[model samples]
Target: MITSRLMVLRRAVCVSWLSSCVRKQNYCSSAKKTRVREALTSLDSGSSIRIQGWVRSVRLQKNNLFLHVSDGSSLHPLQVVASSDLNTRGLTFGCAVDITGSLEKSPSHKQRVELQAQKIEVVGECNPVDFPFKIKGHHSLEYIRQFPHLRCRTNVFSSLLRIRSEATAAIHNFFRDNDFVQIHTPVITSNDCEGAGELFQVEPAGNEHSLDEENPHFFSVPSYLTVSGQLHLEVMAGAFPAVYTFGPTFRAENSQSRRHLAEFYMVEAEISFIQSLEELMKVMEELFKASTEHLLSHCAEDVELFHKYNSPAHREQVNLMLKRSFNVISYTEAIEILNHSSEQFTFKPEWGCDLQTEHEKFLVKHCGNVPVFVTDYPYDLKPFYARDNEDQPRHTAAAVDLLVPSVGELCGGSLREERLELLKTRLARTGLDSTYAWYLQLREFGSVPHGGFGMGFERYLQCVLGVDNIKDTIPFARFSHSCPL
Candidate 1:
């Protein structure tokens, strides 16, 4: 009935707007705010265009002043050539300027076309001495990390930002195309989805009232910033056949490792009625490949910038990762391979122990460094939610971890324990039966076999771009003790 009503409503709306919704121009129709990249890409000679962007470089010739301006649309900046007769007032590197110009074919071989500016107005000025970045030469990613607020002005970071935006859209598109419902999962909740005890506590501001027993707590039972949305996606999957959530997830681990972050974006999804791990793995593989292909097609120039300048070694790895099928191995097999390896790992290879970064890297290396999935982990290592593999010789959970080249564990997931009594027993053993009683109710009322997976958004970006640190992928680096704006 609900779906029928939705269909009727959609039809009604469509019918009502047929006459009113005449086709409109596809692109932005603006005379004042022309994007620098678009203006450069669609250069029409003798056309007057007003463009605004931050100055990337300035070269003052005897007869002309040439400036490369960028508005973050592309890796390459728009070349604006202004004669000395024009007002070049307050023009400097990092200054935001609006230029009214006539587009013309470039006389020089460097650029296809250049903007011949008739007027130049500096909207915002930056003092060269105080500016953190130089007008010329590439700055190291670490050096730019210091100025998180202004690093977007840099070519490398700007390209990264573009890739991130495009990748996000591509991911959403893939899910939408695959008939998955997008869920806006809560950021704050009472339960720890991962049960890792690494949640960031969410509390009100400090005051005397906060200490009062009568109204002491914000949310009576100690609310926390969610560490994962997997559990919530699982809830939605009960109603919707397929559900996914992409949002910020918090963790309070204090490690200062390059991979650790206090907060990061996660893409999590839950699917109902998945019979086997193979079905779940197929969706994972498709999601990764489709979204990556979209990025390669849509953000070609931005990706090229990373290959040409940022991380040259990743160029071939990325191609192979996308072109070929991902390899798979059982956790037992991975352990055997690790044990027989010549390289001594920091963490010893053992049957029941969790795989560390070194161990995961070795497993990926064993498969020739393309993405690989390791399945059937020790039951004890997995969470209470994982489905039990009773048929296996040793106690194992139907859990899988997708490991990529640079980033060890790119994604983790499992077939959930849909059996009511089994879930109850597992939760009881973990002392979370009462806490997740509502979660158990889904199994009791009506539950089918279900499973889901979660990927760290930053980690995926790091792996794709060959970024050494997780901090570089995000707009702002948030770590154990650092939260710079």
Candidate 2:
């Protein structure tokens, strides 16, 4: 009887312990199932949602906490309200967090929505003392430039970047739809495409030497960063009827103006057997219109901000640009117009003189906000590769520069000199090496009438966004005095 009682008591104790273990396992499983909710830009009233983003700002009241969070999508902030038990302590600006809440339409403002938080999860921490950005006031461009990595988090910079991205996509789509083959050109080039002596030299490893070195340094071959990809695109155009190259180009020019950059992007296109400069101008007009219209359709918020802050003249300019047809004029006519204009230019307009930025701006702004292509430049003023007009005086070349208001000389193009003999004569005149035997071979093999143009990508962005500087258009700007993270 005693043994039976002991066995029964032991069995009962074992069963009780097993039941407790099972209960604990169930509790753990339920806790592990808890997860963050999906993110929605705008939530309907009386609907529960969860959001995750960096905390932009925070306010603490006696019994509640108000937090503004940004998820890097829109310019506006999402207002989050949390109760006192949500552990608001150690919550600093810029820290990432996840919040579960019921969204409600703002009683005071119809445009705004509020989230009342039921739970809060801190994903990351930020030190307020060391944080570079603040929620109180705006920072100057010069100050924000110091922190390039962090500046993109701001409203203005974010808007500019979004627009830049949309513009790039629009350009690619335009070219793709027009049957233009996208070509990638080499960056480290041995040839000078732009003949404008503004090239950044690259030396071989261990080739550094003093200027007074008696003998040429070992492994020192003259190399340079390409100023343009026009020549390379021509080679591709020979294979493909229509081709374009969009990539980075570098220049060593010591320009201190808002227009120039040490390194910038260029969009270059070359076509084979093109009919006339008129056709080329048509392409330019269509491309600009397509790019602008695409951006306006997609980037509404960015366009609104751009018009509000940077260019109050955006609506009028865009309307004028869309309605007005491009005006075709010769270099001589451009000079005449500049000389007749009331605005006195720094460099007085003269024949054979390259159009100054001031001269080009006046022609575009006053002559109607349409692109003007000034063609048939004086032979001596153009590069050796440009086709010279036989009928015109001074051996003028068939070159064109598309100028627009605010952004002068947006593009430059010319019909290539196809005649081998004439090209050789022009090359000799310009002092280029005849040793470019491979390039000459293209003409020898059967070169046809071809023309191409190069548009400054940053300049286009500047015009579209109405941003003041080229540095802001690019993510990492390389300038004279500054190169920062």
- Candidate 2: how many backbone clashes? 0
For model 2, the stretches where C-alpha displacement exceeds 4 angstroms are 1-50, 100-114, 129-132, 140-143, 204-220
Q: Which stretches of candidate 1 lie over 4 Å from their true place?
A: 1-44, 208-215
Cα-based TM-score, every candidate: 0.91, 0.84
Give the per-residue lDDT of model 1 (tens digit) for 246-356: 999999998888898998999999999997999999999998989888898888877877877788868799889998899999999999999998989988989999999
User: Of the candidates shown, which would achieve the greatest lDDT relative to the real structure?
Assistant: 1
lDDT of each: 0.82, 0.75
Query: Residue 20 lDDT in model 2?
Result: 13
Look at candidate 2 and tell me the lDDT of residue 485.
55
Residue 172 in model 2: shift from native, Å? Answer: 0.3
